[model samples]
Target: MKVIRFVLAVALLTTLGAIQALEPAPMERFFIEFKPGTGAIIEAGVRADGGQVHHHFKRADALAVSVTSRLAKRLGSDPNIVTMEPDARRYLAAKQALLTSQPLLQSDPFAEQLVPYGVELVQAPLVWDQGFEGEGITVCIIDTGLYEQHEDIDSSFVLGGHSQDPNSQWFEDGDGHGTHVAGTVSAADNDIGVIGVSPGKASLFVVKIFGEDGLWTYASDLVAAAFTCADHGADIISMSLSGSSGPGPERKAFESLYNEEGILSVAAASNGGNRQRVFPASYDSVISVAAVDESKLVADFSNQNKWVELAAPGVGVWSTVPHVSNSWLFTGGNAYQGEPMEYAPDGVVTGQLADGGMCIAAETPGDWSGMAVLCERGEVTFAEKVATVMAGNGSAAVIYNNEPGALLGTLGEEGGWIVAIGIGQQDGQAALDFLGQEATVQSSAPVPGSSYEPWGGTSMATPHVAGVAALLWSANPAWTNVQIREAMDMTAMDLGEPGRDIAYGYGLVQADAALQYLLAKSTE
Candidate 1:
């Protein structure tokens, strides 16, 4: 009788689980408040109603106002609240928002290598033109959805799972991360900017796991999304979210999916720059990826621990962003005066141009005649300081970066006259010193075909691995996920302690080496 009942229970659980998958799970409510004068306000949750408020005494001229139990009592009811730490929630919220923003993308200006500029370009060698370009592969990118109209990924969106509550197809990337991930996995190779590892190859499954504000509904949402990815035929899944470790239903769900369905899951080890491991990444089944820089050194910020399986380029790495060009730079000035300026010779500067930008030029006083020359940086916006140089009778502008930091500024696209360029701070300072107040610039050789563009971070690193995975899978369709993983690990050029250390993990992922390894294993 017990045996029959156990079988019956298992059957019922599976049936109900399928039904729940069709509905959006219930969400808990949280509150937030804006820190005054910071221009950043909490996006949702904490509001003026029954929400608790803390007064900033300096902003107000009173001693201490009388405490009201009403707000205190309301806060007490919710367990999610009233753990009552200091007002550190503000910092936590800001960090999350910033992570969701393009911090890494903006950091690319300082990168010495060109690979980090975008996905297709960086991982091109990993892509193979042969069999099973991830055909029928459903990769669920549980992130902000795609722009829906992106030329590379529009055709890959399919609707196998829908939320009963909203009853709509999930196909948009609200934070831009998912779209970039999708593009790396299987963006069609249509003679565009860069080529995906699997061009015209795989089916990308978009799973909206983040909120509009780029926060999660719950850690449980991650687990649920994984199941949906599984049920919807996702052969391989990649997630770039990790902070704290989690267990309970989420962990159980992941184990079941991996063990039972033979699904391959890969995740970011983390960018915390410490020995601490983030959950899910630290989990046993998922492949946790650390990061390496251009010199093939481990990224200083990538998390390390026993769980890290491999490393890839994370520093100043770049990938595509919707509404942003594959190879484009934004300026901080308007083109109201004349045409935009050009760049200086390679190794001329270190950083990028700021708001009051500059156009770097090759050679010296001769090239400076038609272009508003941008110089290197010491302090202030390279563009701003470069603008001072351009004022001496050049047409448009010049930009450079300081010795240590990358230059970042918005482009002023009102007209075509003023072109702006932000450079590295280290390079900027070099230019400034070289030119002496105004650029008494010297002539030099033509610019190399390889100059740096701006990009940054582990968010950048994640897609490199994704693209590499595509290439490996394409070369040998019969190789299992474990084999592909082994190929990457074995082929990676070890950079750390001679044997898998934290700073470079297994080493830099070598595309040709990985392909050779995969092919060799296939023959074996």
Candidate 2:
């Protein structure tokens, strides 16, 4: 978008000579810092000059602002202001993560008290037998928010302030990200949904940072939320969001929260499938958590960097979710033909199923958002076909076999990411019967409604570390945050090349081992 605007501005300057100078400068969001007691003074100056103050961190003497580039330059040289940086927007790995969840239409009795693979992988049950289920400990979740009425959460006190609006009640989680992460930290041990590592014993504090879409938030919002966590009685802060850039001030804020407030912070290493250092998690004061599967192997998408501190179960980890309308694909009064093409993301997509002949990159439509595209299988690999649909902003892809019955196939070993479905050759042509009609695609299952769900991401890995930190802290309330972290590092199951390497940080966080580690250290 910025590039497009820049190009337009250049073309205008070339075509129209004198009018170019009258063109308004693009507005940019930034984090502004002023000397102590000067936040009001700096903010006043900004607002008087056609600037908007998004938020004020009175404690840190900082404010997030949006202003023209000209105003920003003027503020930089102002003696009253300390520093300024572009407040970059950090996003949830919504597209990268395999966000698979299905509503069961029927209640299964055997599934009662079902233990999720993640809960078991961290050995939370073993520590439960010792009767130290994160009792009296507090874990703060900084994300969208959680459903207060959720039976599984059972939080004693629900107190949170949205970074978007400091005065607004940040308790409703429109997207299930916060609810799922909260469930992993402290869902009740009741025989309904899956239990959390804390098992209904830990106190929960929250800070809703992400918006309803579960998309992006500025880094400044996250920094402000940390202060809210510390102001409350949170022993640990769990953040499931990540971004590319971390300015000096943001890092300083996290370090101050840990060092000054005695708070332990845990964050996701990101789902980038590469070694790019993502923010919040990559900070020295926060423990960076990576993702592993049920088999305890590192996930393909989990970021691997030297700064990563620990690994936990993140693949297909079952947990709790908020109540939402059924997200199932239906067309022509019947369920859509075909299965979730290998790695389709969980979403509710409703639109026209346009016929795109062979879904080759060259022939793909430029705009396919809010539309399901039907493509013939051939002329390209399934991965390439799906890629074309995704690049064109498609909602879902319906691929039909070139010749034959029902199309039952995979998107190769490395499956595609779009909500892809494989249908028979006849079904593909038949789909045109309702050509212009609306078709839907979603993560659906034939069963009674269920409150539980499963999600995959480094977002899933963060709560594992935070929950274990709470358990270990509760085991010995006398220890400080630093001591608890050191003990965890010492006791974690060593992965990679014998010591702390990139993939699986100190190794998987062990609840029982850390408890024992702290006890042995106390005895010594």
Tens digits of per-residue lDDT, candidate 1, 296-409, equal 667677777877877776665433345431122222321111112233221222223222333232222432443335544334433444445454445434444433334444
Off by over 4 Å in 1: 1-132, 154-169, 324-455
List the RMSD of every prediction in angstroms: 18.8, 9.8
Per-candidate TM equals: 0.57, 0.73
lDDT of 2 by residue, 1-524 (tens): 99999999998887787677777668899987778888888888889998999888886778899999899889989898888989977777532222122221222222476677777888888899988899888888998877778878785744544545443346777777888898889888888877888888888888888776677889888887888888888889999989998866788888888899899999999999999999989999999999988778899999999999999988766677775323344677766445455555656678887877788998876788778888888867777788888888887888776664334334654554777776656667777677778898775432322366557899998998999998888887889999999988888888767889899999998888888888998999
> Model 1 lDDT vs. the true structure?
0.50
For candidate 2, report its TM-score. Answer: 0.73
lDDT of each: 0.50, 0.78
Residue 141's lDDT in candidate 1: 62
